[model samples]
Target: MSPWTMPLVSAAVLLLTGAVLVALWLWVNRQSWTDQEKRTLAQLEVVKVASGIALGGGGLFTLYLAARRQRTQEEAQADINADAEARRITELYTKAVQQLGDDKAPVRLGGLYALERLGQQQPDQRQTIVNVLCAYLRMPYTPPPERAARSAKGVHRPLLRNSGRRAGIRRPEGQSPAAGLVDAQQERDVRLTAQRILVAHLKRGGESWGELDINLDGAVLIDFRVSDGLFRAATFRGATFIGDMYFLGIFTGFVSFAGASFVDEANFGGTFRGVTRFSEVFFGGEVAFSGVSFAGYVTSFAGASFAADAIFGETEFVGRTHFRDSAFSGRAGFASAWVGESAIEPGSSWPAGWTVSGEATSRPGRDGHDGQWFRLVRTSSAAPPRPPTARS
Candidate 1:
């Protein structure tokens, strides 16, 4: 209560007490005191006592309610502040990535590092965002906190390789190359872009046969998603596939052909490596190759249905290979090529009498021990014992 209210209450109490005293004084001063007046004085005293108890109890209850309401409001405000902070952190992290460069490298790295903190506090949303960001950074692996910490962290570096930098150095739309020279500026831009993203993604981790199709000349590392999407036509000319390259899960709107290849060596064994699928894809342009070689567990067309000719000339498959159940509509020639392997099983049946002619092809070593698998069951005497060379 206010200071004024306290004084007023004191005055009311004093008036009540004085009135009671006056009544008592009058009784004592009276020549005769009635029983009815005595009863009225007793009732007045009981009412005053009850009023004092009720007023004190009501004041205490009101004070408790006010305190509880204040505490609840404070807690609600705290929760709101916490939510705002989380959203701000997430936004800051996204900005750091979008505007990343050498000048902003500090912010970029800080943003990635901050995820470790935010993820600790707000585990759910932070983790989801972290997973996506890590993917963009193209880090090979991203583990959860405890395990990630337990194992040594992989310092993530990014590089771009064989981006459409090959978009140049080719004959112009209506003009042929001036003799045997390339536009030097175009070549430099292409080389620089490749060196940046390539040195990180490829040179560091060393993966294979993968097509990273973003626009050329951006100088953006592999640290971002292909928001504009895959490349139109890629070139790996004079580029070595030291590691098994992969292009299976790619969704390129145009063609991807790796010509002029050094596909397989000791450290470089080409396999399906991972799942390779080119499902229902159309290649308007030809997939030309001059000297592409494959070694190791190689699977070129796995569940792939090609509408164009998989024209392989001077190409070599030196290991367990399969073009199993794949459709090659146009001509498929293994001309002047060699296959030196323990076994070569052909799965594609020629229903259209589709030609798979190898004009000057030679198998390095031929074994007759494979007779159990392909020995003749029906004799065609008219065809002259179906010569063992033909093997009916």
Candidate 2:
């Protein structure tokens, strides 16, 4: 009931009780009786009032006890239901993980889907499921030789002939090494499926897994792409990216690609809000960072190598930036790039021929577009650095 209405209701009940009491007193006074009878009638009236009060109080107490009991029962039921749900989730998770260990590729794919579905249903378990997938990718794996390489010069070469035996791939007495290659191919497909599952949920919009940290250290990613993703933190240290890589997203926390290798073209256009690293990275194909914003404590590309064109046009560096010991075999460009005045750290190095302009221009601040900004320009016609030696 409303607070205002409750007071009115109580007042009405009080008035009704007063009126009934006054009527009973008047009736008793109007009756002509002796003093003894009058005293007896008064005693009877008192007893009746006391009995009514006792009954009414008892009824209210009973209602209070019943309501409390009902509340307790409901809470108990809710607890039981919650416990059952938790058990069900645990069972499903265990089953899916077991399936992942199956020898058949189809079974492994099914397990990936099962885990994906579980994550969608149970938001709290999403990170755990993602960790499992990353672990699977991190497992030692050697991709099957490309079809072109195997068929080159009309020779049937089995790339995993010796390793397959060591890996315990059972074969018939006269089975050929090609059987092991087929198994490798199957494993590759399973790994690719896991990668797809991760990319599907990491991207922005439709069923996106919000701001999860990803750790794929030393993992091999084939044709990885993170278009429009939001990461809290990520690590890809010593990872290998086969085929093209696309990283168009936002990193709100620390991100590292140190000691990584990109075998194909890499296109990076995103906003890095925390410390970013690319130390000792190798880019076998063209790499571009056009229009990218690095707003972090430090952005390093130290000891990195670019075998093909390295483009950094219109890039913004809002914090300490480093390109020390970096090598570029092909053409390198930094046209119209902006760096904050406080971003240049002592001993920080740029490309051999490139230098920051003497005049500091006004652009937006870190939050806005106007602030003190310096442009990078080519001051000399020096040759680009020689490519680094090939890895062992």
Indicate which candidate wins on lDDT: 2
Question: lDDT tens digits, residues 1-392, model 1?
Answer: 35685556656655765566566555555635478687677667655655665565456556766887788999999999988997897686666455333233344445444544444455454435434343433322222233333332343324535667554445458533331122222222333333333323322123221343332211212212221122223322222222222331223233222222222211111122222223222222233333333432332443233334444554444444444344444444444434433224463222122223333233332211112111111122122111111000
lDDT of each: 0.37, 0.83
Q: What global local distance difference test value does model 1 have?
A: 0.37
Q: Could you list the CA RMSD of all candidates, in the order they appear?
A: 19.8, 7.8
> Which segments of candidate 2 are over 4 A away from where they belong?
1-45, 148-175, 345-347, 365-369, 383-386, 390-392
Top-TM-score candidate index:
2
Can you give the TM-score per candidate against the true fold?
0.29, 0.82
